[model samples]
Target: MPFKKLHTNILERLERKDITTPTPFQSRSIPVIKSGANVFCAAPKDSGKTTTLILTTLHKLKCEAVGNAPRAVVLVENKEKALELYQAFLTYTKYNSLRVYVGYEELHIDIQKSEIFEGVDILISTPKTMNKLFLLNGVSTSQLKIFSIDDAGFLIQKSDSSAIISITQSIQKCQYVLYSEELHPKLKRFESYFMEHSKIIQI
Candidate 1:
């Protein structure tokens, strides 16, 4: 896998951080992702999908330096899941100059009280929060490089029709990666929508 062959910078970063071996999901998906293809990965929990996405997003961000308009990489997941992912990304990219933010159910409350997502490069959010932010014009999707959905099937099943529509409408040109444990029938419909040229890899 060409993509699995980490770049010199990324490999050096991993080595400095004591991350030598790639996980199963990373070994399989990284190569395909680096090939610049849309990917849909189905694997069990704790299979390293999150780490793969974080690393890939970092690689993309580094390759295409953020423009003046603040390019962002978005991850949409559940509220409970957001915290874990946020912490993981923070730990993984500690040495990198990446800015991470968490947008979940009550992000508005924080925004109303104080500034929340200023200078955020990576956003981990839920569907509802993302829909609200899209509606309020708080975040711009135009500069997004990576649009990821972790536990995508679960999120789609839990999301309202309008929310789903809003999120899909906001992100048009992003390279998408959808991860889930099981592929639901409902999520398959999105293949024709957001993901046209997609590869489904079961781990």
Candidate 2:
């Protein structure tokens, strides 16, 4: 039923993709994510966690492109996942005005910075690359609305966790969503930092 409340653009894309039903995890998590609170979404693989992240992000941005400076930022574990999520997001954005940009360590930060400067709506990158961007002022968080981490289990690594913590420091306020197979204790620590008053959805 929560899908019914999504933006028409998202609904249209869903219909086009023949995705008519929400998985159990999505059924429970979508409405909560739409509420605009920071969330920890824990579900096994193939539970539609990635799909929910995509739909809710587009919904939050009203499924359209706006000013520069990404409105949505998705942190992936590595280059592979970053590009994978970028391609997945493209399916929904194909017919919309939204712009999706993918950045990884392999890509020169300078190239990423200039391309991002052109205008980007949704940005997908690894935590390390994101932290570097923030440090270099390569990406602007002023217009950010939502920040989601796909398969966030990798954040258990001290370096990745530290990078995320650093990235949050520059961001003032925005909805945060972390998707993972299980909620590790380290991830829970985020509540003490930027995830204030956060909600948890475990399936």
Candidate 3:
């Protein structure tokens, strides 16, 4: 019944996609995420981790567009993952009012700023790009609600972890969720930065 806890629009989309029966990971993690806690979701591939990310994000936003600033931010490893996740989100958001925007280094900061200023509900980007956006005041965190990192094993790098820490420092308060195939030690270190008192869901 985790899917039932989602927004009506999201539930409708899930039904349309014939996505009933939650994977063990989704069944366990979705409710914890819905509770608005910082979570580290560890699961193997094809266990519906990404779907849980998309579903909980939509549920948090109430499946609708709001202010110009993004309420949800999703961080990925690089441009390819950013674009792939963007497409995946689109399949769920296409019939709803929520607006999803993707950003990476290839796109000019000015263009991203202008488009985001116009309006966006969920903002997806690489850690470096997101740090740059925060530094330049390209996006507002005043309304931010949730910040999730997808396939976060990449954070093992010094540069990427540095960027992520910088971004978290700028945000006042928000839920942070990290999804990965395994719980890397480096990721656990994030408890000091933004994952304070975090919950872990392993499947």
Best candidate (score: lDDT): 3
- What TM-score fits each model? 0.85, 0.99, 0.99
For 1-203, candidate 1 gives per-residue lDDT tens digits of 43336655566667777877777887888887767678888889888887788778778777333433335545555677888888877775676667777867855545821343356667787777777777776777777777778777665554543476567776768787888887777776777777778988788
**What does candidate 2's lDDT look like per residue over 1-203, in tens digits?**
87899999999999999989899999999999999989999999999999999999999999888999899999999999998898999999999999999999999999999999999999999999999999999999999999999999999999999999999988998999999999999999999988899999999
Cα-lDDT of candidate 1: 0.70
Q: Residue 117 error for model 1, in Å?
A: 6.4
Better of 1 and 2 by lDDT: 2
**Angstrom error at residue 32, model 1:** 1.1
| Consecutive 10-residue window with the lowest summed lDDT within model 2 | 1-10
lDDT of 3 by residue, 1-203 (tens): 79877888998998999988898998999999999999999999999988999999999999899978999999999999999999999999999899999999999999999999999999999999999988999999999999999999999999999999999998899999999999998999999889999999998
